[model samples]
Target chain A: MRGITIGQYYQADSPLHLLDPRVKLLCTLAYIIILFFADNPYAYGLATIFAFAMVMISTVPVRMILRGMRAVLFLALITVLFNLFLTPGDVLVEFWIFTITRQGAQTAAMMALRLFLLVLASSVMTLTTTPNKLTDALERGMRPLKIFRVPVHEIAMMMSIALRFIPILSEETEKIMNAQMARGAAFDEGNVLKRAKSLIPLLVPLFVSSFRRAGDLALAMEARCYHGGKGRTRLHPLRYATRDVIAYLVFAAFLAGMIVVIRLF
Target chain B: MKLILDHVTHIYDPHTPHARTALRDVSLQIGEGSFIGLIGHTGSGKSTLIQHLNGLLKPTEGSVYADGKDIADAEYNRRALRGRVGLVFQYPEHQLFEADVFKDVCFGPKNLGLTQKETELRAYEALQQVGLEPEVYDQSPFDLSGGQKRRVAIAGVLAMRPEVLILDEPTAGLDPGGSREILSLIASLQKERGMTVILVSHSMEDVAAYADRIIVMNGGGVTMDGTPAEVFAQADALKEIGLSVPAATEVCRRLYAAGIPVRPDVTTAEEACEEICGCFLR
Candidate 1:
C-alpha cells in the first residue's frame, strides 16, 4: 500500500521526456507564471491548448493522465468550490446562501485548468527521465549553493536513493503483511480501537524490517566506497543539447503568446 | 484440530488491475497433533494456503474451518485467534524491534493484554523453551547473533501459548548447525506441547526426517498429501516439482536399483543403514 505513485511520470518516447530536466523544470515554472496571469477565457484556453500539445508530444496515454486527474479530483473540486463561492463578484446564480458569480466561475475554471496543466507537464518530465538523471540535473543546477555550504550533491543523492528504495520497501511490506496474516493476524476485522491495535502487528514488523534494511544498505554503501558524494566523477555528464535549446525556445514562445493573449484580449 | 479448507480459492488484490490468484480451489486437511510439512517452490501458494488455516486470509468463495469452527466467522476475534495459532515468519529475526530481548519476546502476549506478572512469566518461560538465558532478557535483540534473533522472535510467538505453531521457512538462511538446532527445538516442542506444527520448507531432507505427514503444493493446489514414505515413493512426481526425495530415500532407491533388496520406507541415514543390514541378513 505504501508504494503509491507519488509523482506522475508517463513513460513515453516522446519529445517531452527527451527534453533536459532543467529545461523542462524552467519551462514548468514559466508555464505556471503564464497560467496565473491568464485572466480571461481566451487566455486560459490558449494555456490549455499548450498543455494539451505538450501531453500529445510526450505520448503519455490519455487514460494515465485521467487516472492522475482522478487521484487529485477531490482537491481540484475543493479549489474550484472555494473560488466560486468565496470570491465576491457579479452573482450569476444563487442557491440557498451560496452564490456563484460570473467572474468567480471564470476564476475557478482558470485555476483548475492551471493546476491540471502544471501537474501534467511535471508528470511528463518525471515519466521520461530516470530519477538518477533528474537528481543529477538538480544537483548541477543547485551547485551555486555550494558557496553557502548547502550540500546540494548530498541532498540530491539522498533523494535519488529514497526514490529507488520506495518500491523495494513497499514489496517488503507486502511480504511481511502476508507472513503475519498467515499466522492469524487478520488486519480487517476491527473497530477503530481494534483496528489501531491490529496495526501493532504490521507496524512493529515494518519498523523492524526497515531498520534492518537501513543497516544493511548503509553497510553496502560504505563497502562500495560511497563517501558523502565528495569528488565523485560522473560517467554521464550533464550538458545542454540542441533539443534543450529548442525546448527553451518553444517555452519562451508559449510564454509570450500567453502574455499577448491575456493583455490584448 | 482438523484444519479443513473446502475448495478454497484466494485472489490477492482482488478486483484491482493487479489481481492475482494465489490459490485455486486448493483443498487439504491438516490432522490435529500431526507435524505436517508443507513443501513447494516459490509462489506455489504454500504461503497463501497456510494463511487461510489461521484465518489470516478469507477465501474468495470458500471456507476454512479450524477445529470445526469457521475461522472467517465475524464473531471470531482475530487477535485472539492469532494468540492460539502462532506463526513464525521467514527470517523472523528481522521482526525484532523492542530495545531489550525481554520486551521483544513479550510483544505477542502483551498484545493479548495479559497482566504484567503473567506476561513476564510467559515471556521467561518462552525464552527458556527456546534455550535462551534469563540474563539475556535485558540485552538488546539487535546485539544478538542472527540465530538468537530468530529464537527471540520465535519466543515472542511462543509467549502467546499457541495451540498450533506454524513456521514459514524457520531454518531459512541459517548455517547447518543452526538449522539442526532449530529443527530439534521444533521437534521437542511438538512432543512436549503436542502442538500442531505446520512447517513450510523447501528442504526435502528436513521434511522427510521430521514430518509425519507431508503435503506437497504446486501452482496453488495440493498436489499430494501422504505420509513421508508414501510421498517419497513417488520420486518422479517430487522431482517434477523441483523437489527431491530425502537423502536416505534417494540412497535406498539407488540400492534397490543396484538389485539390493533393501526396504524402501527408510528416510534417514540410521534407518537406511539398519534396513540395508537387515536385507543382507535376510
Candidate 2:
C-alpha cells in the first residue's frame, strides 16, 4: 500500500505547486487532449519534453514520478503489445499466424510513449495539488451543475471526505491485518479460495467501522450546523491571482509551442 | 516461553522519502510469567517493539528469538509462534468481525487449527475470563457497549491461550471504572493463570501498580529499564522524554520536599500511602 505513488500529493515549493488547482486541472486535461494530436516524431519529442518539464517545474522528485509510472506499466505494456502484433502492415517478423510489422513497431512505441506521457502529465498535477484543493477546485468547477439540481455540493463533500479517508482507512487496514495475524489468521498462506475466505475477518470489521466513522462524521458535521451548500461560505475561497494569470500565460505559450511544432514540423 | 529481542531494529518504509526508524538497536529479554509494562510516549516505538515479539513484524536488521529460535528464520513455524505469542493491538475492538461475540473469540483458536470442541471450549472460557455474561455471546460484537466490545476483542486473543499475551494500551479510551476493571482483570490473569503479559501503555501509575518491570522507550530506543521504584526514581529524566512520574509518585516527591520522612521512590498511591503511614507511625 505504501508503494502506491499515484494520487499522493508531494509537498514542494514550486510554480506548479503554487498555481490554482482549477487551472492545473484544466491544463492537465488540455495537455492530454493536445498529446493525442501530436503525431510526428518531433511532435512526440516535444510532448515528452513538456511532460518532463512539468515534473521538473513541480519540484516533485523524478524518482517518485517514475514510481507512479510503474503502476500503469501493465496497461502501457498491453497497449504496446496489442499495437505491436495486431496492427497489420509490411511484415517485419512472422511466426505462428502472428506478424510484427514495420508500422506496428512504430505505432507500438508511440502508443507506449503516449500512455506514459498521459500518466506523467496527470500525476504532475496530482503530486502538486493537495487533495483538499483538488476537491475544492472540483466543487468550484462543477458549481454550474447546481442549476440542474445535481447536488454538486453533496458530491464534492463526499469526494473530500473520501479523499480524507483513504489514508485513514489504509492505516486501519494495516492495524486490522496485524491484529488478525497475531490471532494466527494466515492471510498469505492459504490457497486462492481460502485466502479470500480469510479476508472476511479483516474486511467485515473494516466495512462496519468505516460506516460507523461515516455516521460519526455526519453527526459531527451536523452538530456544527452543516445544512448543505445553501448560505455556506468556504473557509478559504478560491480566487485567481497574478501567479494564476502567469500560469495561464505559460500554459498558452506551451500550447502555441505544441501547435506550432505539430503543425509546422 | 522466554522471548528475546536480540538487537532488533525496525525501519518502516525503508529507503523511501517517508522512511522512519521505528525501532533502533534495542535489546531486551522477557521471561515467562512476568508482567512487563512497556511505557513510552506516542510514536516512541512502543507499538513497533511489541509487534516484533510475536513475529507480526520482521525486524529490518535484527532477530526476534522466542524459546531459543529465530522467528524470522525460514525454518521456524511462524503460524505456531503467533498462536503462542498473541499480540492484542491498540483499539483491538476495531478488529472484531464475526457474526457473534462467541464466534469472534473462537477465530483465534480456530486459526490455530484446534478441534471444534476445543475452539468452543476456549471461547467459552475466554468470554467468562473477560467477565462477559452468557447472554451477550449470541449478540453481534458491534451491538455491545464500547467497554463490552473491548472485552470481546481482548477475549479474542485470550481464546488463543497464548503463553505470552501482549496488549497495546488495553484500557485506552475506557472510562476510569472500566479501565480499573480491565487492569484488575489482567492482573488476575497474571496471578491466577501465570500468563506472561507485556502491557504497552502511556499511564505511569498503571505500570507502577501492575508491572514487575518497567521499560521506558524514547525515540525508537529503550531509554530506561528497571523495576517500578528504580525507574520512578529518575522522575526528572522521565519528564525530559515527555513522560512523568505517576501522580502518586509526584505527591510522594512533594511530601519529601515538605520535610516528610517518606520514601522518595514511591510509585503507586497504595505504596505512597504505606510509606506515609509508616513515617507517621515512626
Candidate 3:
C-alpha cells in the first residue's frame, strides 16, 4: 500500500540504524550546520561526497534515497532557479536585462547543494530511525523544557502518533478517493475549481473518519490506563555506544573544517 | 458480456523503492450476472484485482476486458468505466461525508451530470433499495448508526447504477445480526438488478451461503476457483493457504472422516443436516 511505503524506516542491523537516536538527532543538527557553513565550490563538493558516503554507510538502498529525493526534486529545482534569477551579484555575462554572474552562480549552487544536503541528511536519520525512537529521544532530550511547562512530552507523543498515522491516513485517503471515483467523481480531469469541488466527497469522509479513529484510539488508550508521561518505561532503552562517540567526533571535525573553509577560502 | 482478465499483473508504484507486485499473471473470466465470491488472505491481491475492474488501477503488464473493451487502452474513458463497476470498499462508513442521507446518496448521480430532478429521484430510489426510509433522507448521515451509515455508503454507490457491484469485506466489524441484515440487502439488490455481484470476503460461511462461484487467492495468486461447494470441498488446500472451509463443511468432512455416511460437498449447516438425515434409513 502507498501508506506503508512512505514511513518505511529500514530495519537493519547497520551501525547507523543501531546508534542511539538521541545521538543521531544531535548529529543530524550538527551535520546541517556544517552544510550551511560550507562556502566555496570545493567545500560543497566535499560535503556532497561526505553525504554520499554516509548514505552508503547507512545501509539504506541508494534507490530508496533517490526515491525520497525525487519527492523533493521540484522544490530543490525551484529554489535553485529563484536564487539564480533573483539574487543580486556582479555580472559576468549580460543577456538583455538579465545578467549571468559568477557570484550568483556560486551562491545559487551553494544554496541548492545546501538544501539537497540538508534534506538528504535529515532523510538519512528518518530512514534509519523509527518514529517511535525519534519521539522517545525528543521527549527525553526536551525534558529541560519542562521548567517552562511546554507539554514537551505530550507534543512528542502527538508527533509520534501523527508520524505513525501518516501512512494509515494515506491509505484511508486512497480508499475514499476510490469510493468517490466509483460514484463518478472525476479527480484527474476538470478545471481547477471543478477538481477542487470534486474533492468534497473524498475530503469530508476522510476528515470524519480521522476524527472517529482519533476518538476511538483515545478511548482505547484511556481504557488501557495510558495516562500521559507519568511512569512510562520504554521497552528499548537507548544507549550511547562507541560508534556514537566516533560519529560525534567526525561531526565536530566537519564543523571545524566548514568554518575554516568559509573564513579562509 | 463477461469481464475477462488475461494474464493480468499489477505492480504498485513500479520503480519506487517500495514497489510491490500485488497480483501476478492472474487470469479469470467472471460471467455476467453471476454472484462470485472472492476469498483471499490479507494482502493476497484480492483488493488489487477488484480495483482493476473499474480502471482505478491499470495493470502493469496485462489486459482487462470489461464488456469486451480493453480497460488498459490509453484512450479508454476511465470515468465512464467507473460508473459501470461500483466498488464498495471495506469500512464503507469511512466514505460518508454529505450533510444528509439524501445529498450523500445523490452525490453519485450528480457526478454523472444527471439533472437535479433525476439525481433526487435516483437517490430516493437507492435509499428505498437499501431499506432506508424516505423520512431519514433529510437527517445528517453522521447521526446514523454504524449499520445505517454502511447502508448509506452502499446506497451512494448503487445510485450510480453500476452493472457490476464489487463489495470488499462489507460485513467486517459488524455484529452477527448486522452482518445478516447487510448481506440480505445485498442479495436482494443483486436479485432485483440482476447485477454481477462480486463479494470479496474472508468469511467462508458468507461466501458459501450466497455466492454461486468462489475464487480463493493466497500469496498474490489465485489458489482455487470453482463453485462454493467445489471450493469448500478442497478443505486441505484452503487450510494450506491459511483459510478454511465453512464450519458446516468442516463438520461434514469430520463426520465423513469418522466413517459417517455424509457427503464432503455439503457446505452449509442446513444442507449438512439434510444430507445426514437422508443417509439414515427411516
DockQ of each: 0.35, 0.80, 0.71
Report the lDDT tens digits of candidate 2 across residue range A73-92.
Answer: 99999999999999989999
Model 1, span B16-50: residue lDDT tens: 66689999998777776889899999999988887
Please give the range of 10 consecutive residues that has the lowest summed lDDT in model 1 chain B.
Answer: B90-99
TM-score of 1: 0.86
Q: Rank candidates by lDDT, best first.
A: 2, 3, 1
Interface RMSD of each: 3.4, 1.0, 1.2
lDDT per residue as tens, model 2, B1-282: 999888999999998777999999999999988999999999999999998898888999989899898999998989899888888877755688989999999999999999999999999999999999999999998889878988998899999998999999988899999999999999998888889999999998888999999999999999999999999999999999999999999998999989989888888999888998999899
* Per-prediction fnat: 0.29, 0.89, 0.88
Of the native A-B interface contacts, what share survives in model 2? 0.89
Alpha carbon lDDT of residue B50, candidate 1?
77
lDDT string for model 3 (B6-75, tens) is 8999998898666999999999998878899999989999999999888888889889998788988889
Clash count list over all predictions: 1, 0, 0
On DockQ, the candidate that comes out on top is: 2
Cα lDDT tens digits for candidate 1, A26-129: 77767776777778888878878888887778777777677667766788899999999988889999999999998889889878887887776676667667
Q: What's the C-alpha lDDT at position A261 in model 2?
A: 90
Q: Model 1 misses residue B35 by how many Å? A: 0.3
